[model samples]
Target: MRQTNEEKINRLEELKETYDRFKEKPFQLNLKRGVPGKDQLALSEPMLNILTPEDLYQETEADFRNYGVLTGIPEAKQFFSEVLEITADEVIVGGNSSLQLMYTVLASKMFLGQSDKNSAWAKEKVVKFLCPSPGYDRHFNATEKLGFELIPIEMTSTGPDMDQVEILVANDASIKGIWCIPTYSNPTGVTYSNEVVDRLAKMKTLAQDFVIMWDNAYVVHHLKEKKEHVQNVLETSKSYGTEKRVWMFCSTSKITFPGAGVAALGACKENIDWVTEVLSDQTIGFDKVNQKRHVKFLKDKKHLLQHMEKHAELLKPKFDSISNLFGNYFGEESTMLEWTEPNGGYFVHLTTMDGCADRIVELLADIGVSLTEANASYPYGVNPRNNSIRLAPTSISVEEIEAAVKAICLCVEMVSLEKELDSNK
Candidate 1:
């Protein structure tokens, strides 16, 4: 399989011709988003019909219309508590979109500070966060918008490099928090192990009120027959008297309608009370009717699993298609590219040859194929290595995934070859 100088040149020419032929087609293929496809969205149609004339009131006897339940309805608290495996008293259901909730949490800290320590982030000389790289960009952006310095830690197999994390937090009080997508992490899809969780819960930070933004956005979003387990960070926090240290966030955005789904936060009593107080000033209540629809459809943990299983069935094939392309189209084993074929979550983490991601994305875009912009997974939208790409396989059809992967592989090879040629010269 070794190619000589002449052969590599010929292969490059052949790829250019093939790419040109694809460009001649009149269709545009977009794989840029991680949104649920129409078919996936349709799965929630049953929820729309789950509510009827017989039930306008919750079991707690709270009316769905009038503003009464400040945090959430009793049943919603019960339902989310079961799903998150936390006590009902610890869960606070909020409006749709966990991203919005996450931003709200940060905003509250920046504006009002936590109840116990009222050092507003804006007043701090230098507020910083330990960001695990190859992470969710939105999380980084939230901190960035408020002007908190983001210092990235290397992502290891088990989790963020603990040695680096422990050292940094121990030395600097300015490092107030870390952003983690613990279960089935956003782009890379590696769940944090129990040992990592234990260390985080016990880690020493100079800041008395250090926070851990544990965005468990994909806790139940499984994509394999054998589901993965992410150790409960919040629960572990209790043992260290750090129960108020972590803020856990999740939503039914993927489970039901992303546009109208409900979100929840799992925390200790202190954190829960603080957020409730701040949120009360903002609004009387979140949408109870929407919460009712979700509770009616997903009655308990078992029903939630059953519903997620359907999403897995619809998504697995698309994931397999990307795997096949990695082995078949790119190579059975490629040196030019590397990726994480996650067992769960919505993305496949792709890393190209050094200094090649931006070029590959640009090359693909010229041919009417769209992907997430390069460096999107990192803080500041700048992948220092310029080699990482997040591939969202669950939103498109099998055919679209195939086409998109082919084009992606083509651009990958194209950029890699160009690099090799330049080095030789």
Candidate 2:
């Protein structure tokens, strides 16, 4: 039997009444994050076995414990360089998290200043960044922490609106940088098209030191039934003769353990030299032991691809489960709600009727379900539409996902119905 809106609404009311019965109790389930689940961690058990103390502890030419190479081990650099599609010298392997490296890059420019640019960002009258709307909040937070003004740009399925980006960058000398997630972007799971990448590469900015902070966090996490290719930003930069204008960042946080992963920054020689000089003032070098472990575990590109295939296998089912549930619950009433069926990455972006997201989230929380804050994807934690919500299906079990999705749909209906009823009254 097909469930009509009224039937769904009545069902939602019943669920709410039952949920209210337990509102005072503590109920906990965390679906508010995109962290990989336990099954994904199992794939890295081989890494633990690779580096026993008996195997290689001394600081030999081949051994990795004591610090000699500041950039990274030659083999590891060569391997990741291929992954990032840049020359070996252009890549610098840093500590566990890419977020830290990203902060260091910005902070270096703020306090120490870059070679091409003279004024430290802190001394500048107004330092502004072009932030794509509904972007990664942590990126916004990083710039905001440094007192940089964030200007929101709309993000399209293809990429950030290039015309607006080019206009702002070309005209404003204060627009020093932009944040981009080229492949499988954080909340929306959208990739930049070839033309978009090319345009970004060829952009004429007023600021000579204007940088494109490209964070390709989900480069290999494709969820499509067929294989999809992502354009190489570094290559595009070089082709457009704008190699120094782009800085590419990636990490093994999703591939290996998050806290104990290696991060890399790919850029032109000038940018690399500038960053290395500034970085030395802070620390002698990053951990080489973990870098060796990554190389040993993911021996080469072939090995890394094989490992990612395993992750895709585990992840595809979870994505399918949530998508199928959404379709079953809301497919017929498509006029009221909408969501993206992503091909890659760890999220499904959903949008509700205007001003209804906060209500839906609150209703879900009351029923022992948790979600990413309604406006978390936007600048200053404010979603102008107040409709977009990020769904992270990676951290929960299939069974839990089923319950959570069902609860979420009911909450959506409950909120929508209340709004509809209030308007009629």
Candidate 3:
């Protein structure tokens, strides 16, 4: 039964006392980013010792200590090919950050265009990129900085609202591209269904040079026994002869070392050639020594999966702790808040009742818990409803997570009661 107004007012007063008590305690806990825990990082420590002086040269007589493999070392390319499920020729292994590769590709398209077949996107009067909401903020920031009008697309359980995507792109010549984290997406943890993937591949766009930025950062980061697989964008696009329109990226940033991991891009042969040609002017090549090191450490896709299972073992408990606490505090029937229980991926997305998220975040901050800014998953850091909060439980200890979560639950109840009390008045 719902509480009477008088009871709610009394409860609010009691909660205010508890809030005052919390303020008296002093501690700092951060959930701002999805960084790997100490234990997770420790798992890859053996990688640093894998290389020796004798292993410095490849069988092809290429000196890894020197330079000259512009695309990538053959072994590195072969390893990424197995990881990306593409041929070695289709992959262009890059530096430690896949985000850098993505930025370069977009910048290239903006100024240079994909090929002579189309004009540069910068030449267009107004260029726009489709961003699926409850998505990655870094992606939105990138496009916005590059001067593209960031159009927000509604994200569903299966994927983006394709009906809207289909209609908008088909009618608007300015809608040039879409950003996708197709499998185990950043905050929401929703994977694109096969049908959604097929539609994206075959969709008719008004822009002849429309692009799809597929960042598969969590492809091997599985938290459950069953591994999630997304339909291959490059292979799917091949049927429609749209392979060049897809640029896929993956990295060992989370797999091994964020600072010195291997990153790669998978695209059509033509696009790979184009990127290779453009990159020749950027630098001699990425650090081949590190590339060779990763190849030695990871060895193959099978070994990569085995390594990721260790990550899952470390991460699964933290995710479970969040889920259990949320359920206990809010209950199955609560309408005040809802959160995702992702099978894989780094974040849990919590959505409070409409108009309450910002207040909750502010309350948490006052007591020294840092969350991703409210509605950060949306483009321009705005969610008109003001209800989304991305929770990152990876970096902190489970004990800290418990304390932080309990504090959050208290704040949720306090804010929710306050909302109802005001509504009744």
Candidate 4:
């Protein structure tokens, strides 16, 4: 039976007692970022000693210990090519951070321009990039730092609302690009469907040199038996003569050591040549030693998938715990509270009742549980509804996950009840 106003008030009092009990417990848990735990990091420990002196001087004999191989060694390029399913010529094996590579791509276009015509976006009157909400904060921060006005687009289950994307881009010449996490999007774990990919490929834009920053960070990070395969954006755009519009990025940061893993960017021939030419002045090359290390450790796509399965084995239980706890606490009887059960990504996005997210976060913090800041997923650090909270269950242990999630559920229910009772008054 649905609870009456009086019943809700009584429930709030009971929840407050539990909340006070939580405050008395001595524990500090941080779930602010999606990071691989110690166990996950331990899985890649063997890679540190996988190489030797002779291994460094491979078939190319390019001298891994020396400077040069500006765009990356041929073998490194080939490895990432198979990973991204793009041609070897289309890949540029970069340094440790894919985020850095992404920033470089945007900064390159902002200053030097995207083509031979030298149409620098920095010279333009106003430039904007479409950002899908409940998306990655770093993506928003990157473009915002580059002076591109960040526009929030509604993120649907399939992907960003393409109709809205199409309408906005078709009318605004100043809208230069959009940030996309195509497969297993950050926080939401939304993989773009074929229709969404097709619409994005064929969409008309006022800006002739518009681009798509495809950050496929979680491409192979699957948590279930069934893997999702998004349509080939590069091929789809090629049919529309929009091949130059796609700039795809990926990295083995999560698979191996985050601070030392290899990253790469995939693009059309023109983009490859353009970025290569631009990068020439910037550096001699990325860390070839680390590149060779990852190449030998991960080996091929099959082995890479095998490696990720290990990650899933460790992560699946934590995610399952979160799901089961949510069902137990916030069951069908709950109102105006929901969350995404992501398949592959590192976050579970929670939506609390309106005006309740901030309070829920505050309440959890009081009990020594730290979460990602409320509204950290949106552009400018603001969710208009103020109802979104991102939960990262990757870094902590399974026991900590259960404790944290239970505390979260209690706080969520308490906050919701408090809101309901206040409104009734």
Candidate 5:
């Protein structure tokens, strides 16, 4: 028999009765992260073996061990540069973590300051950044830690609300930058449309030194048939004469080992030169040894595409399982629950009825399922809607995903039922 929304509500009430029985036990299961599962890790084992000491004990024509290539070896930079569709000179190869590179760039500006720019952020009376809502928490945290005021911008399926963004940038001289994840944005998985990207590229900011911190983390992590790729901001910026207005970032954290993979920064020559000036004071250079390994393993675009297919093979099942669960449990319902079916990337953004997220999250936690904090996606840990929740299906097994989704649906149902009851009262 097909269950109507009311019937589902009743069924959920019954499930809650069953859940109440187990409330006394301590609950623990983590579906809160977007890290790759163990199966995905196995795919990168070949790279490990390829980089062993025995494989290159003696330095070949290109030295792997020592250090000295501040801009990275030509071949390594060339290989990764292709991934961004930019030239080698426009890319700076960094050590394992892209997050580290992002932090370094921001910190350098906050402490050491940029060349041809003002002194450190400390000298400014107030510095502000445009934070797209329901964004990467770590990005927000980085700016907040440095005392920059974070102003939240609402996001649409196409992209951040550009009208408001332009207003903010055009009027606020203190608004120094905006953080963007153009492709497969963290929890939402919504790719920025070309129109949105173009508008951003052409914005006339009040601050001359304003920047768009573009974190293209999932540029190649597609789950379904390929969608249209957004134009490179580096290229788009140049077309609008805003070449120095963007700093693009990417990494192989998902492709290879997260902590041990190489990362890169793509920007205009002026921006790169400014970054290099401060970077000289920071460290000698990033890891060149891993750079050689990445270049050797992922030799060309063909190799990269083939390797990513392996990741897709492992990831698709997990996403499918969770999506199936959502459909099975809520397809017929007209309740205030909604979610995005993302084509790629690591998360599904879910929104419940207003003021119900915290309750639903608490219910799940009480029943042996853990989720990312309900408001962790929003700026300053406050979701204005109080309803958005991020679902990360990458780390757990398919079976665990099934179990977690079942528990999550029950919690959602309970919250919806309670809301319905309150309205009736």
Candidate 6:
């Protein structure tokens, strides 16, 4: 329903009062990140206590107390292999986080390059990476900090605009990488189509070492009865002799504990060997004792999948609550606002009318409603249209999410109508 200027004026005043009242409540509501809830973390308590003092070493005769394995324990590698659909030999398990693994891989390329035969990336005159906008900020930050100029690419429902991606990569030899969250992508929650992945695998690049950061962090994080799966990226790339071109990663951070979960990287044997050789010089090995803890508890994919079902129960409600609210408040009535209905990811991507998200975010922030900074999902923290806001419903309580998103609806309407009023003049 298009509102008359008079009705909008009255609604604006009412929303301002609502914002003021929320500001006075003196309570903090944080939905700015996709961190798992406390209830989700508690499900992994068995992992911590699973290992008894009696079980100090793994069956491979490797003592967990004294680290010797550099490429992670065999059981953990096999476990990750099962989860990622790559071979155990191709998986390299690491400590607690995938972001760190991703950074280290990028850093290694800068100084060490991909292999002994290749030149260091830092020596390149102009290094660049194609970044799909509305992507993972932490992924962009990893390359940005390393001096690789990030060129933003458009994100469509199927995937990053593959046509643009193809043209840019084909023309720019220096464009060595592109960031992708193929399955249930970060904020938008759309999976890459088979065609997109096929092109990504088959498309040729001048930079022989061109890589794709395939972060399938939410691989098992499904929210519905039926689960969606992406084509086996490693296998697809391998078929095209480009398996080495993709660096696939996932972690139990959200599954178990963010700070103590196990992370893994999967690639062809050549890349895995290169990383292990470099890592051997860096340290004895990662905390195998921690690896043992996880392996002993999760044991296999069945247990892990069952564990995730519990998490889906906790998260589904939060996502549904906010989505329903969006439909109710910012529906067909408004040409100025739209949001994503993600099937199984941690975020809801909301887009207000052009030039309105930042103001809506600021207005909501004034009332103790903290969201992921507007456009934070984009490269360099700039969302050019100034209208995308990532709403994370997982971290906050159901009650808090209800209140926080209602306030967001208020801010979106207020900003959108204010813009409409000015445009009318």
Per-residue alpha-carbon lDDT of model 1 for 343-364, expressed as tens digits?
8989998988889999998888
lDDT of 6 at 268: 90
- Candidate 1 lDDT (Cα, 0 to 1): 0.87
- Which scores higher on TM-score, 2 or 4? 4
Clashes of each: 0, 0, 0, 0, 0, 1
216-306: candidate 4 lDDT, tens digit per residue: 9999999988788888899899999999999999999899989888999999998999999888889999999889889899998899999
RMSD of each: 1.5, 2.6, 1.2, 1.3, 2.6, 1.4
How many backbone overlaps does candidate 3 show? 0
- Please list the residue runs of candidate 6 whose C-alpha ends up more than 4 Å from where it truly belongs after superposition: 58-60
Candidate 2 per-residue lDDT, tens place, 69-159, comes to 7777777788779789889999999888888878988888887778645667777799899899778989999999988999999999898
lDDT (CA) for every model shown?
0.87, 0.83, 0.91, 0.90, 0.83, 0.88
TM-score of 6: 0.97
Task: Give the TM-score (vs. native) of candidate 2.
Answer: 0.93
**Ranking 3 against 6 by TM-score, winner:** 3
TM-score of 4: 0.98
Model 3 — TM-score against the truth? Answer: 0.98
| Candidate 3: pairs in clash | none
What clash pairs does model 5 have? none
Best by lDDT: 3
- Candidate 3 lDDT, tens digit per residue, 1-425? 78899998898899889888888884498998888888999998998899998788758578989978989999999999998899999999999999999999999999888766358899889999999999999999999999999999999999999999999999999988999999899899999999999999999998888999999999988999878899998999999988878999999999998888889999999999999988999989899999989999989999989999999999999999999999998899998899999889999999888889899989999888899999999999989999899999898989999999988898888999998888888
Q: Lowest summed lDDT over 10 consecutive residues: which window, candidate 1?
A: 53-62
lDDT-wise, the better of 3 and 4 is: 3
Model 1 stretches with alpha carbons more than 4 Å out = 58-60, 116-118
